[model samples]
Target chain A: MNRRDFKIISEWIKKESTVLDLGCGDSTLLNYLVASKDINGYGLEKDIEKVQESIKKDISVIQADFNVGLEQYFENNFFDYAIMTQALQENKNPDRIILEMLRVAKEGIVTFPNMGFWKNRFQLGFLGRMPISKSLPNNWFDTPNIHLCTFEDFERLCRDLKIKIIEKKVLNNSYSTNFFLKLFPNLFGEIALYRFEKTN
Target chain B: MENKFDKKSVGIVVPKTAEIKHSLSLDCGKVLEKFSLVFETYGKLNKEKSNAILICHALSGDHHAAGYHSNDDKKPGWWDSCIGPGKPFDTNKFFIVSLNNLGGCMGSTGPNTTNIETGIEYGPDFPIVTVNDWVNSQKLLADFLEIEKWACVVGGSLGGMQALQWAISYPDKIKNSIIVAAAAKLSAQNIAFNEVARQAIITDPEFHDGHYNKFGVIPKRGLSIARMLGHITYLSDDSMRQKFGRDLREGKLHFGYDVDFQVESYLRYQAQAFVDRFDANTYLLMTKALDYFDPAKDHGGELFKAFKNTESKFLVISFTSDWRFSPAKSHEIVKALLKARKNVSYAEIEANQGHDAFLMPIPHYFNVLRNFMENL
Candidate 1:
């Protein structure tokens, strides 16, 4: 949604790490990471125009679908970090794809819009309709986010899957967290960014 | 978007012949004591003889890849769309060379050329030449031109296969390779189509086992049938539907096997025109080479291993509707290049022209080509 998530992801990534950016639309984050961290990596995108843009930026990108999985194309543990920015909910199976990412990389970083935010709750509970807040802008019928998840729901999934959450960042609409967000992130936080590793 | 390199700028260019007296060894272990090659060159080679780019021609394609052969000729070379001054190939920046393959019907030594020893047309007796053979012959031309290494070797379809072979055969001799709409090997279905075309040519009574040249007769019917079949594979269903569809040629169906459908009339015209210029034996050899191409076979059944020793960077392009050499086929090559850790860029353009889309002036396709050539 903003450069905040990209900056946080870049901070988590180490210099010279081999990274793979999933659904790297136009490769804005990947390009930033390359310039800041000097990382060697590739961006996997599905749109032809986005892939071409990445090429123009001198980023190595492969035009592919994230739903089909990356098992056949990339080697195991070849990447140091697999980053997905605001695209986890759009995945057909987030759990399976995250596991797939862990298989190819040692660590995985993902960001998603928090459906349990206060505004969304107020819209769905008081208005008696699907929320259409700043974070969830699309209408209920046309939204690309198939699996809307809250901060707690994501943490619960990590615990269930035994994935180690190395770090977590919760942000509001302006991409900065306040005391209210720290106290009740599931209610106040509009976006959640996580850095995790597979225990297995 | 000015079309600076238009038809009028096609300017005077002619094919030149080079006779190599050295005995060349083929991949099939055959030997040709001597041979001749027909080629055309545009742009000047620098003093260091370095800025050379070789354009390989596909099946039925000859040395005339760009520019007019004579002032009166109405049509330029087949790939004039992308080759010229300030174009993707950019004659201003590089020396462009295109040659008729060894087994082609063009001025090069092919089925129509006279055998050195027999003093008769080689016809069907011409030894089978593989992609490797073509690359070897091109090297002779490179040597004669004083180019120690080509800046790039580019081709589409069968020509693309030769480009791949060039990188594999002499990794140090080619700096870059542009392979479009080509595969490492043909599929079973692909081989089946070629087999049908070959059958059409050989079964004709006039063929007489490819000695029609000596009998002062041409297997026009058989060649026409083969060309007609090849034309179908070169185009996609959507392309054919858009171009001809079920429209009647005379506004009413004859219903008697006469050219009723407009598509039938189009195919008939294409076949007849092809028969007038091409030889049947060359068609047979071209298909045979396509079937025999399998660079991965000798490399432990792994396409990646085939590129392990390749030193040249590659730019691979494929079209969406090119069922003859689908995007999946192009992916096979791209994936192998990646596995081998070679520098590669791939693009699958949206197109409805099928295999022939590589020859068309698709804006995005040309943009990628131009960018790649400029960067190289």
Candidate 2:
């Protein structure tokens, strides 16, 4: 099933654009983009099974760690877009990876589950326990979302890194966005998608 | 794309020999003054002569890569499962050529061949050759066939190393390369196994300093043991255990060392069959060739620099369970190709068949090959 964030992420990507999907799990995003846009791309996956899955689908994927840096695999300004979905927070250095993405591609599209949602806040404030919701579905001790951030935190980080925020799409659990949800995305939006490029 | 040829019908073909009266300069500073190469071809070479594809064989593999040698033959070529009319290396679209290397025993100039200098079998006197030497020899065969450039060079295991060497040595001569279950260089452990296999043959009582040919004696026991050891490395533990667990050869075990387990019997049969068709000195040279394969050594110890001039698009594949030539080794090649900024595709297939998985008819593996070839 295509995630709501992926659908939004696809809209920002131009047709036939070359993509490098970092932390590409099973490469469903790459496959979908290829089928719909006829785009040429490769995926970098650390999981062996997922890499095999991508290969079986006839998708080109390299089994590699994103944390190890992309300079070894990609040349500067090589790809039209470098995309990472629901995998930024899990990276060792999300800021460094974003910078590397901009160095390798003209633009980068990133999507992650927002940590500042009202439900997550209520669980921590009212229940006096670590938040656990449908979006963040892991126990506190066993979770990959190590560097989770809200929409505001990501925007602030992007500004500090001199990365131009070209576009942003705030989405609820079901993808529908109301006026109030747009106004207070950090508190209401479950997932946040952004398209950014390096500032001149 | 749909040719009306029956997909199931075996391509009944015979191998031919190309007599090259010219000397081949070996990589180890030795020259093969004259030799003949036994090779098999499938399909027609197009008008442009551009559809030629070379299939390099592994250590024990021969010139028979596809089709049945005889009409009554029960099995087709060694790689028949993937080289038929509609198979991955589709004969309908590509002219496939596979040859027995210079030091090979299968109808080629090898230890079994009579040396013109002394009018005796070369045997152990066969000069040590490298993968580079093998590629150069194949290049001569290509020149004789009037093929300017090959559409693709495809191989697995040692054969894959040959494919890589073709791209590195003759960069512009190849358009694509499919290297499966191969490595840039053998690990120390890999060399140890080859050394042990060589020792087994050399230490045999029947082996009289490689003079067995003159004495009309074959190192059967030593060769058999070497084949058995090679067989164990070819298959994964899971595969061997699955194929032959603790099952007894007989209904009950005698508790002695006389082939109690079914696995022991299976290894014996494999060894016997291999020794009957293969020569001891040829095996020694092949292993030595494998041990010395390191394309990066001459390029300032940089594999990426070695491919700086290569123009061939690569499709590198490895099986997950192939610990002998593990995914890690395959990744080293891929990393170098990526660093070189060459067009490359890699796949690690899910398989438990180990190193021999490259020869199997796994759907995913065949699909990857077909996809890459179609795209090429």
Q: Please, what are the lDDT tens digits per residue for candidate 2 over residues B1-376?
A: 2323346544577789999877899887888888999999998899999899999999999999887776667767899888867888888888999999989999889989988899988888989889999999999999989899999999999999999999999999999988999999999999999999999999999999988987889999999989999989999999999999899888897978799899999999999999888999999999999999999999988999999999998889999899889988998899898778776777778899999999999977887787677765
> Candidate 1, after superposition: displacement of residue B180 in Å?
1.7
lDDT of 2 by residue, A33-137 (tens): 888778877888877667667765667787677776386567788789999988999988899999999998999999898889999989888998888988899
lDDT of 1 by residue, B81-185 (tens): 898887899888889999999988888898899998989889999988998899999999888777899999999999999999999999999999989999999
- The sequence of per-residue lDDT tens digits that candidate 1 reaches over residues A141-162 is 9999898899988999999889
Model 2 misplaced stretches (Cα beyond 4 Å): A1-19, A23-41, A46-60, A64-81, A86-108, A113-149, A156-191, A195-200, B1-6
Model 2: interface root-mean-square deviation in Å: 3.9
Worst 10 residues of 2 chain A by lDDT: A49-58
- DockQ of candidate 2? 0.30
- Candidate lDDT values, in order: 0.88, 0.88
Fraction of the native A-B contacts that model 1 recovers: 0.09
